[model samples]
Structures are given as C-alpha cells and as structure tokens.
Target: MALTLTCERQGGNYGPACAFSEILALAERRWHEWFSQAPAMGGPYRDQYYYAWWVLANNLVAPFGQLRHEALVPSKKQYIGVWNW
Candidate 1:
C-alpha cells in the first residue's frame, strides 16, 4: 500500500530494493483507481482525472502523450518539439 520509489542514485544505502516490476504494478493500480473514480471527460470530473492523465502522460512519457524522449531531443530544449505537440 505504500507508494514510494527509491532514488536509483541513492543505491542500497537508502532502503530495500525496489524492482521495476513493482513500480509498474503500483502505477497501474493508481491509474485504475483514478479511472474509476474520475467522471467522464468533459463532465464534472473534467478538471480531475482527465487532467491528471494529461499531466502524467506529458511528464512521464505515458502513452497518452504520444511523445518519447527519443523523438524529443538528445539535449533539453526550451520548448516542446513537434512530436510532443
């Protein structure tokens, strides 16, 4: 039930090892909870779950964003690239 991720850079000194699979499972659970609790798009929940998904996708390269780091740029850019838009 604890939702947490270790800073990879911190290594073993931080705490127990967190597998990538665990992260994926927790992310899916959180997503499902949001989907179920959230109202349909353009409805009262418009500003809730839908916005949450958008933020998650854009920030973490979720499928909804349709943009990946590979297409963005090798180096950080001041603005989002065409692929991201």
Candidate 2:
C-alpha cells in the first residue's frame, strides 16, 4: 500500500523494488490496538482504515518526487476522517 501510494503521486515512478511491507504491518498493529481499546467503534474494519491512514500520514516522510507515476498524493480530505477520531 505504501508503494502504491507513492506510485500514485504526481510524476512519480516506481523503483525496481521498494520496502513497503513494514508500513502495512505497522498500520495493522496500530489498528488492532486502537479498536481493541475502542469497542464503541464496533469494527468491520472501519477503524482500521482510518488508523492506517493516520499511521501513513504520521510516518510516511517520503517526498512526492520520489514516488511512482501511479502514486497518490496525500489529500486533505483523506486525512480528515481519521484524524478527527
């Protein structure tokens, strides 16, 4: 997912290989911890998605220029939903 995001950035280009698995793993762990503590959310993975975005935003420090053409820009809207929680 990290690789996909970077690739979706403007004028980004994918490398021969990238190390994004760790990011996804970390995101999953964070989501589990969050939901386990916040049972009111009543998961079906909604909280997980939001938490994943939060983790990505907080940790992904790579520049847009370093991403692949298919990579996505981190949009304000994308960050709003999770951060509000």
Candidate 3:
C-alpha cells in the first residue's frame, strides 16, 4: 500500500493543475538542487547529515503574513509560528 498527497495555499486563485507524477518529479529535482548547494559532508554519517539538512529545508517558510523574511522553524509539526530572537 502507498499514499501520496500534495498541499498548496491558493490564497484566492487556483493555479494551473499539475499531474501528481510531474509534481513528484519537480520536487525530486528541487531536492537535488538544494542538496547540491549544501556543504559537502562525508563519512559513515553522510546519510544522517543529509537527513538533518532535509529537516531544516522542510521546515523553511517563505516570507508571509507578519514575517518579513524567509525563516526556518524548529519543527513545523510543533511550531505554528516563527519568532525572531
């Protein structure tokens, strides 16, 4: 069994529709691009290093509402808002 889901905030306008496979491919390409820019880290912990980066990237949010700049939250599942410290 398998499940796949995509979420988007349309605000008011619904953007052009995209096939699920296309969306997945685009996401994969984006992940590759992001990983390429990351600092190179190698060793037995290479996978762990990338996983940490993935977590950070996944939690990133664009400037929205009161946020004036892009930000990263500790955990999207636990944090509902961003705070500047």
Candidate 4:
C-alpha cells in the first residue's frame, strides 16, 4: 500500500502543478542543500547527529503572525509551541 499527503495554506492559491516524482526530487535536492552545511561527525553517533539536525529542520517554522523571527517548535505533532530558552 502507498499513500501520499500534501498540505497548503487554506485560502491560498494552489501553486504550479508538479508530478509526484518531481516533487520528491525537489524535496531531495532541498534536503541535500540544507544537510550539506551540517558539521561533519565521524563516529557511531554520526547517524544520531544527523537525525537531530533533521528533526530541527523539519520542525522549523517561518516567522508569521506575532512570531518575529524564524523559530523551531518542539515537535509538530506533540508540541506546537516555540521556546525562547
């Protein structure tokens, strides 16, 4: 079984259409560009290091409403609020 899910802001115009493969390729390219800047970690913990960075990036939210700066939420599913500390 396979399933694909997408989300867009309510009331926002649907942007340009893209095939699933194209969308996946774009996401992969963007992830590579972002991950390329991550500091190198060589050891058994390397995978954990990258996973932590991925989690942060995945939960990052752009400034919106009262949020004046880009912020990272604790977790998109469990916690939707940002911390100042």
Q: TM-scores of the models, in the given order?
A: 0.36, 0.29, 0.66, 0.67
Kindly list the per-residue Cα lDDT of model 2 for residues 1-85, writing each as its tens digit: 3534332424555555435786577668877785566435446987787776555545434444554333333454545322121
User: Clashes in model 3: which pairs?
Assistant: none
| Candidate 2 TM-score to native | 0.29
- Over 5-83, each residue of candidate 4 has an lDDT whose tens digit, in order, gives 4534557666766678877887899899989999989999999999988988897776536677777787758775786
**Candidate 1, residues 1-85: lDDT per residue as tens digits?**
8966653433336565778898789878877886677556776767776766655444443233364542322223375534443
Best by lDDT: 3
Clashes of 3: 0
Candidate 1's error at 43, in angstroms? 10
lDDT of candidate 1? 0.56
| Model 2 misplacement above 4 A | 1-18, 40-85
**Which residue window of length 10 is worst by lDDT in model 3?**
5-14
Worst 10-residue lDDT window, candidate 1 = 68-77
The clash count of every prediction, one per candidate, is 0, 12, 0, 0
lDDT string for model 3 (19-85, tens) is 8888899899999999999999999999999999999888777754667777778785766776454
For each candidate in the order shown, give its overall lDDT on alpha carbons: 0.56, 0.52, 0.79, 0.78
Return the lDDT, model 2, position 55.
Answer: 53
* lDDT (Cα) of model 2: 0.52
Which ranges of candidate 4 are over 4 A from the true structure? 1-16, 63-69, 83-85
- Once model 4 is optimally superposed onto the true structure by TM-score, how far is the C-alpha of residue 75 displaced, in angstroms? 2.9
- Give lDDT: candidate 1, residue 10: 34
